[model samples]
Target: MWGPHLLLGVLVVYTFGRVRCQFQYPTETAGKQYQVPQPPTYKPPTNPAITGIPNINTVLVKPPPFLKLLVAVLYGYKINRRIKPTPPIKKCPEGWFRRDQRCYFFSDKKTSWYGAESLCRLKGGYLAIPDTEEENNFLKETSTSEEVRLQGAPIPHFSRWIGLRSLDGSTIQKIITNELLTFTDFVPGHLASRGLTSEPCVHMDYTSSFLWKVEKCHRGFLYICERHLHFEFKYIV
Candidate 1:
């Protein structure tokens, strides 16, 4: 009963079914990637009411108890003078007498013996005489760093004179001012141009450690004259 026409019809139906299935839309749509923006984040306000907290008071900070005690202790010491500052000690000059806390130099260069006495009288000091053992000892010690007596006047010898003199002009002797004199028995002598053989002058050299030495008065050298420390210093000119 089924001939060629029925066979052709079945083939056409099968072909049509295949073609329709090929043209049908798929269940899943084609996907496209996209980027989206998020909402802004919030920030809290600075006011105390919003935060529900009390404000700090910066004015009234308390010092530590130990700190206060330490400060008080230091203040007490400063006010009370618990540790008093020591005053400086005054030192007198070596090989010199301290008069009113000052050192006086009688002579430095050659001066005549009598001239030296007169000079001392004028200046306000006497021919330095070591009155005490201490003075004599000080003189001896200050006279040299080495053997003073051993080194005999630097050998080549710078001749000078001392205040020691004789009224009779015979022997070199020590003399004193007659009274408790404010000024010397005499004055500091200088090497002036005196032709007289009796012109023995007094001289002093600090470095040589030679005290007033007696020499010819005519010698040319620098001389020093001492006066009381309390004496008002001035220039005659």
Candidate 2:
């Protein structure tokens, strides 16, 4: 009977202790202890003029059309003044025709092969030497069509002495380079058909349609002189 009474007392004391612990802490109401933030009380001014502050565009004014045009014109004029026009492209001398980087002087008078070469040397150049097909074509096209006579002998065909000749009659070469010809535009059978003679020189035969032909060096013919042309700068005011 004592054990049962003691057990009942222990149980009653534990229950009272739990009740006191619960009452010591305060309780919080739902959604009241931490409130949600409300919207701002004052809104930004809708009319910037009424607020005494100008809009971004108004504060940063754009230049007028005429002012912009004037500024552009002035800038262009300044640039033009600073930058002078590039010097004019160089030109060949008087009575000389320019082609690529070379200047050519076609002779109006006929002379022998040696005479023509000497004259060309005196004039600061050499006999016309065509190293390319384009140059050869130019030479052919530029050659005068005027009749060429030998000692008042009325020759039906005209020709010009070029820079090609074979000293040994076996090895053709350019006098300027003193080397064997690397390029040849000879007529198909002209070389094979021609008989070799002493001191035979080459000429552009108009009768054979600008093909090359071997002839005696003493014979007179029109010739072309060639020289390198350089750029000449000319100033403009």
Candidate 3:
């Protein structure tokens, strides 16, 4: 519905945007930087003080020049109210993890179940272990977004390959409901130990929320590499 008020607001916005382009651009000029003198903490006797007064005792006390200079520089730099920080695309950048409110880059690409676990050790992330509901949600959301980006691709979606495997029953354990999470829409039974088609590695499938399938770990697929980066994430789920 095109209301009169809405039409007026649109006109104002268009005028504002058009008017901004009229501002003049600056020519390149190298500005000269000036240095300031620092005050001395301890002063030696100045050359020949007159009339019983020592210049050392009369010395002025001032802060270090750099400190004052730094303050002045900061004051000169305007904080633009119109300027805003760019929102990051994802918590754990492209091909990364938002685990436990922290961003990690899992460097391990593709390997067998044992090899994947070893790689996590080499890079300091023990597979993609989500310990809390918040963490599980964050990972789920992050993977879902990644899946959206990877839409129409052959592989559904994958974040990281865990050490747990369907072929190797002794090593694999059922991921707890509250803690166990998937990037793809994972339900309870679709992928509970079932990727045993040919290759025996189990990785979560992002497209199927209820499925975690097994694949050949040796073959290289895009992996969510993890490095324990300390960047924090604010979970919004």
lDDT of 1 by residue, 177-236 (tens): 322212222223522333224643334444344544444443434333333343443312
Question: Best-fitting candidate, measured by TM-score?
Answer: 2
Candidate 2 per-residue lDDT over residues 1-237, each given as its tens digit:
799999999999999999988763334644456556699799776775676564679545865544544554455345434433232235666888789878888877777776777666555566787888989988887764334324354544468888888877787888856788777888788777785456468888877777788877767688888777554322221
Best by lDDT: 2
Residue 175 displacement (Å), model 2: 0.9
Model 3 stretches with alpha carbons more than 4 Å out: 1-101, 106-119, 150-159, 166-171, 174-187, 191-200, 215-220, 225-237
Q: What's the lDDT of the predicted structure labeled candidate 2?
A: 0.70
Q: List per-prediction Cα lDDT, in the order shown.
A: 0.42, 0.70, 0.47
